[model samples]
Target: MEPWEMREWYADYLDACNRHDFDAIRSFVAPGVRRAHLPGGADAWVSDMADLFHAFPDWRWRRIQLVVEDDRLAAHLRGSGTHLGVFRGVAPTRRHANVAQFAMYRVTNGRIAEFSGSADEVELLAQLTGTDR
Candidate 1:
């Protein structure tokens, strides 16, 4: 897809995600889509995102920046949400956390083919536990 089209698609995808529109998400992901985490050996990004949204039902991502080149889209996103549920083996603390992530996604046939990213877990943990870091 063209650069403008890719940007537009990503914007829409994020909007759908924020709204928790599963059908829109299904339409955005390729049938063979694969999601991987950065730093290697991490769990699938697709399932991770799903689990994350489940843990923080009010999560919202604010796009800080985005870069599109060839078939790749890189985005810097800042997210904020309340800790209203358990997540990743962590019990509910009912706190709030803010996180920033750098993600790169590859698009094919107008759908996301792959995705990977990194974020600061230390701060997230601190916020969840209401402890200083």
Candidate 2:
């Protein structure tokens, strides 16, 4: 797919996320999708997303920026949510958190084939733990 097409597809995927439509989200993923920095496979991806929603029922992500080159897309995302359930073994703090993430995705045959990203885990953990660090 062209860069423009990929961007359009990405926008739709983001829309699916905003709606918490797991099936729609999975439709954009290739069966062999590999998330190197996290768990691999479509099931794992869905589980991770479900976990996030469980922790923050109102979690949302906004794209701060997006750049596409060939079949690769890079995105700067800002996410906000309220801690209402356990996350990564931390009990709910009921505090709101805003964090940033930088992600890269590789598209193959019009579907997401690979993904890797890094988020502000330190800040998120600090918020949950009520720590300054």
The candidate that wins on TM-score is: 2
TM-score of candidate 1 versus the correct structure, residues matched by position = 0.84
What would the per-residue lDDT of candidate 1 be over residues 8-126, giving only the tens digit for each residue? 99999999888977677778777666666442212343455677888888988899999999999999999888887787678877778899888888888888778777777777878
On lDDT, the leading prediction is 2
The parts of candidate 2 lying over 4 Å away from their true place are: none
Q: State the displacement of the C-alpha of residue 62, model 2, in Å, after optimal TM-score superposition.
A: 0.6
lDDT of 2 by residue, 36-78 (tens): 7677888888888898889989989999999999899999999
Residue pairs that clash (backbone atoms under 3 angstroms), model 1: none
After TM-score superposition, the amount by which residue 18's alpha carbon in candidate 2 deviates from its true location, in angstroms, is 1.4
After superposition of all CA atoms, the RMSD between model 1 and the true structure is 3.1
lDDT score, residue 123, model 1?
Answer: 78
lDDT of 2: 0.89
Q: What residue pairs clash in candidate 2, if any at all?
A: none
